[model samples]
Every structure is written in structure tokens, then in C-alpha cells.
Target chain A: MEIALLLIVGGVVVGTFGSLLGLGGGVLLVPLLTLGFNLPLREAVGVSLVCVIVTSGASASVFLDRGVANLRLGMALELFTAIGALLGGTIAFLLDERLVAGLFALVLIYAATTMLRLKPAASEDVATPTGEGPTGAPAPAGRLMAGLSGPNYRVRAPIAGATGGVFAGTLSAILGIGGGLVMVPLMHIAMGVPLRIATATSNLMIGVTASASAIVYLLRGGIDPYAAAPSAVGVFVGAAVGSRLAHRVDVRVLRVLFAGVLAWTAFLMLRRAAGLG
Target chain B: MSASRPGGTLEIRLAQLLRIGTYGAVILVGLGTALMVINGRSPLDVAPPLDPSRLVSDVLGGRPAGFIWLGVLLALATPTARVIAALRAFIRAGEREMTIVAGSILIVIALGVVAGTAGG
Candidate 1:
């Protein structure tokens, strides 16, 4: 009951703020379950995985209908992420909780810095149809579209998308950060995807990434169905509600607010890592 | 022509659907706000012992700043936010790969649950 109650509440936040800010619920939920509830680190991470699955799965359809998510890019990247997730989950089983926590804090700090420095710029509107590797040189031949730029910005996204997917999978299994914060910025700054598009697409990929590891957790018997059930239901409800309002709200403000929260969360995570809090 | 507009055309079709969704969302938001104001609601928290009520009050411009954090999540997690993101993707790239990816993730979730319980 306690887990369900807590997760249901958390579901609302994940469904709302995740879509609003382009992050996965895992980033917040893992830390909260571990520190606030005194759950074992691995178990907390396992639980966070379920939350991400529920919320993203329920909300992604709306994102799909609206066409905000870039499905092909996300999937092409997932083959890498799925591998990363398997490795990360294995590492979680091997790692010391303290080490994981410390890494978590460090990762959070990095994400915060990126968020703070994020510049609102024009969508490149350029599509590279080349199914090729990331190269430093110009996109070859018919693959080149318009480059997204500000004064010092031109991100090669396909490469970053693949790499970021691996990172998110690893983090999800290890520190339980979900890596959405990382994926969003990378997609925007490196891949040149629009912020909203990045966020939507990120959400789309999350369930798949989490599910990859979720199976591992289940096999290990880390999940508590009683807790995961109601929470998943709640997340579905919240995601439904959030999808309806995706357009009316101002997203930049939401980003600013979410970044602030993450900053604070980083502080808390650091404290927990140090056994100071 | 169905009932609400009685005039079948592109304009009415779009407008009617728009109004239903818009008004429905407003009512939902209003209902949530009213519940908070009138019923002494406790905002959602992933783990308690960390007052969400205060956070809600702070974020929504409600009294006492009771639940600022909760308000933040509530505002962020709406279906609207998710839809906007999804819509943007389709418009930008014209693909449904996201749907497959989400499905893949859920399978991992099931695995995690089974593993956690067995391990626990």
C-alpha cells in the first residue's frame, strides 16, 4: 500500500512534468524512493523503471497522434540503448549503492549545467536521410538538409541520438536517473531536434529502454506487482490528462521551472551520496 | 450536422471537435483546482514525509504555498504536454517509430518487476 500510494502520486508528476520538461520519471523517482523511503538502491531503481514504463506507454500514443515524436530516429538508436540497458542493469547488480549514488549526483549536476545553458533556437528543419555513421565532415550527397545554427551551433543528431540512447539505458539501470534529461538536451543541441520534439520522442523511447531492463529485474524478482499495478494505472490517467493540454501551456516556462527543481534534486542527491542527509 | 453544429463542413467539423477538447480540458483543470481549494486535498508525492501540499500551494498561486512541488508535477504531467511533443515529432519527421520504442520499454518494465520481486 505504501509503495502504491507513493508511486500513484509520483505517477502524476512523471506524466505531467516529464512531457512538460522532456525528462523521464526515473530521474526523480529513483532518488526519491531510495532516499525518502529508504528502499534498497537496486530495488528503488527497479521500481522507477516500472513508473517510467507506465507513464510513457500511456502518454506516448497521444504524442504519436500529434506527430511530435520522431519514431525512426528513436528506434534506430534503441538497438544501442537496449544493449546499454542490459549492461547497466548487470552493473547495478554488481555495484555498491554508495558508488551508484555518487555517480547519480555527478550525472545530475552535468544535466543541470546543460539545462541551464540550453538556448532556445530555431529548429534546423533540416533532415538528413543518410543512414550513415556520425562523421565530422559535411553530410554526404542527398543526406544533407539545412543545418540548424545559432552562431556557434550545428549538431550532428543521428550520432548523438544513438550515443544518448546508450547513456540513458545505462543510467536507468545504474543510478536510476532515466537519462531523459541527458537525452533531451543532446537531441536538441547535438541532433538539432526541437525541444518539444526531443521531449516527445524521448518519452517514446523510454518505455522500450526501461522494458528491456524491466525484464531483467523481473527475472531477479525485484519488482513488487502489488505496488507497480496501481501506480501504473495512475500514471496512465495522468498521461491522458497531460496530453490534452500539451499545446495550451507555455513550455519554456516549464523548462525553466523543471531545471530549478533538478538543481535542487542534485543537491539532495549529493547529500544522500555523502551520507550527510 | 450530427447535433451540435447541424452544418457539415470542414470548418464546423474542426471547430466542434476543438471546442469539445478545449472545454473538456478547462473543466478538468478547474475541477482539480476546485478540489484543492475546497476539499483540503493532499497532493501526490512519490514518497511522503516530504510535504507536497506546501509545494502545490506555492506553484499554483494558491494560499500558504502548501504544495509547490506537487503543483509543479501536476502542471508538467498533463496529457496536453505529452500530446504536443508527440504531434511535433510526427509533423517534423513523419514516423511512428516512437510507438514501437515505447512498447519495447514496457517489456523491460515487466522484466524488472519480476526480477525485483524474485531478488527481493
Candidate 2:
């Protein structure tokens, strides 16, 4: 009972930071369960997947209702992500536990670096294209490309975005992440999507991405219901609170603190991978 | 860029569906945890293997694990449900391209289920 309470509290902390930093709680939850509660890494991953599903589902609704998420773009990219998630889920059970841990540690380091360098107010004003139509819109492109365009920006380099989606989906399944860290940048930079729309669309996609692999974990009995239940509920609550408070908080300070946490967690994960924890 | 927005209704409906799923999951899972605590069952104990066939019976029998498992499954199903909803909307709107994309996503998820069942 006490342990369940602790798990809930831990999940709240993870979810709060995750929302504030625009991350899935899995990045923090997996480390907490494995290192703090002494759960095996695989079980921790399984639990984190469940938590990720909850957080994504809860937050996605708000993004969608606000009309910030681009459903067509998300669906198009998800075809590739779902395929990659299926492949990664199949591979997860076959890999060595230590190898997975090591991979996760590396991902954590990368995530930390990304967070440390995050510039939320960077240039979002994408320049208009040369071949402008009479109404100042970019020249009509292919059907799919035109469908992906938003009000303020035209999606570019879709092939690159789709390629990145596959990689992000694979990482999401294996590491129990939402892959927002990868997808946001891929959409914003490589695909010419605005950052706000990219983040919202990524939120819309992560639940589907996580669910594709979570089904595998469920079938294999990898998830612990006892651990998953409280943690998921906690994340649902924390995410709601965080999203509400997002505008009031100083995100720059939060980013620095979260990066520090990620770095420390990555070091611990490395130690565990080396059998020294 | 396109002149008019696409899939606006789809987004609103999907949002409602997602909200229902999330809230339902939280309630069911939270109830299950409370029941476990009340029954003196340790939430830290090794969990039983999830048997999909027995899910209905376990829930009927008021097993805490059953509720939790069901809730987890519900959460997993929510996103897939959104895909199905999107596919239906696209088909209704005569969007052949989007329908194809949504259909492809469903196929991928179906294949994932098959792989998991076979591998597990």
C-alpha cells in the first residue's frame, strides 16, 4: 500500500516535469521505477509505456479541442511510425536487458542536451515561398503535400519527416518514450512545420505510437497492473495540472533543472548498465 | 497551402473520445487500487499473467487486478479507436488519400497485434 502511494507520488513528479518540458513521462518514470523502486528494467519500461499512454491520451484531447493539432498531418506521419513501432516492439523482447539499458542511457544524454539548448522563442516566422499564388499562398503542390500545409506554414521535406518518424517510433517502443523529443524537432526544422503546431501534433501522435507497442507488452504480460494503475492515474492528474500551469511558469528555469535531472538519471542508468548499481 | 481546413470535425470528435477514454481509465484504475488496498493485497506483489480470455470473468468476480488490467487495455485502445474514427470520417468525407493513410495505419496496428500474439 505504501509502495503504491510512493509510485503515485513519483508519477506525479514525473508527469509534472514531463508536461512542463513537453516530454512523455516515460523518460523520467522508467528511471524512477528501475533505480528508485528496484524494479527490473524491462518491467519498468512496460510500466512507463502504460503511463505514457495515459499522459498522451489526456493531453492530446486538449490540443485537439483547441484546434492546434493537425489531424491530417498526424495521420500521414503515423502510418510510418506505427510500422516502426511494430518492428521495435518485436525486437524489444529479443534484446538483452543490459543492452536496452545502455541504449536508454544514451537516449537520455541526447535528450538532456536537447533540453539544455532549447530556445522556445526562436524564429517561428517561416518565410513565404517564391512561387506565391495570388492570395500569397505557396504554389499548389502535390495533393498530399498541400493537405499537410497549415495556415501559417507549408510542410516541406515530407520524405525527411517520414524517415525521422520511423526512427522516432522505434525509439519510442524500445525506450518507452513518446518520441516527442525527436518528432518535434523533425517536424519543426526538417519538415518546415511551426514549433507550436509540431508540438501539438506530436502530442496527438504519441498515444497511437505508444499504444502500438503497449499492445505487445500487454500480450506478453510485461506490464504490471498494480504498478501501472496508480502511476497512470497519477500521470493523468499531474498532466492536467501541468498544462494548466504552463503559461504561468518560467519555462527557461524549468528546462535547466530538468536537464540536470536527466543528466543525473543518465549517469545512474549508465552505472546500472555496467552492473555497478 | 490549402484554402480551407481539413478534418476539423474529426479533431473535435477525437478529442471527445480521448477524454472519455482517459477519464474512464483513471476511474477504473483508481478504483482497482483502492480495492487492492482495502483487501490487504500488496500492490508490490508479483502480478499474475494477463489472460485476455479471463478478463470478463475476473472483472465480474471483482478482482482488483482485473479492473486495473481492463483500464490499461482501455487506455491502449483509446488511440487505436481514434485511428478508426479518423478512417471512418475520411471515408465519409470522400477523402480517398486520407482514407488510404488511415487504413494503412490500421493495417500496421493489426500486424503489431499479430506479431505480439505470435511472439508472446
- DockQ of every predicted complex: 0.08, 0.72
Our tally of clashes for model 2 stands at 0
Residue A97 C-alpha lDDT in model 2: 82
lDDT of 2 by residue, B19-113 (tens): 99988988889988888888788767887778889888988988888899889889999999989988888788788888899999889988888
Error of 1 at A148 (Å): 16
Pairs of colliding residues, candidate 2: none
Q: Please provide, for model 1 over B27-82, each residue's C-alpha lDDT reduced to its tens digit, 9 standing for 90 to 100.
A: 33334334343544433323222244455544366432233223222322332233
Residue B4 of model 2 has an lDDT of 24
Candidate 1 per-residue C-alpha lDDT over A16-93 given as tens digits, one digit per residue, 9 for 90 to 100:
766556566667777776666666777777666666655565455556556565554455455556657766876578
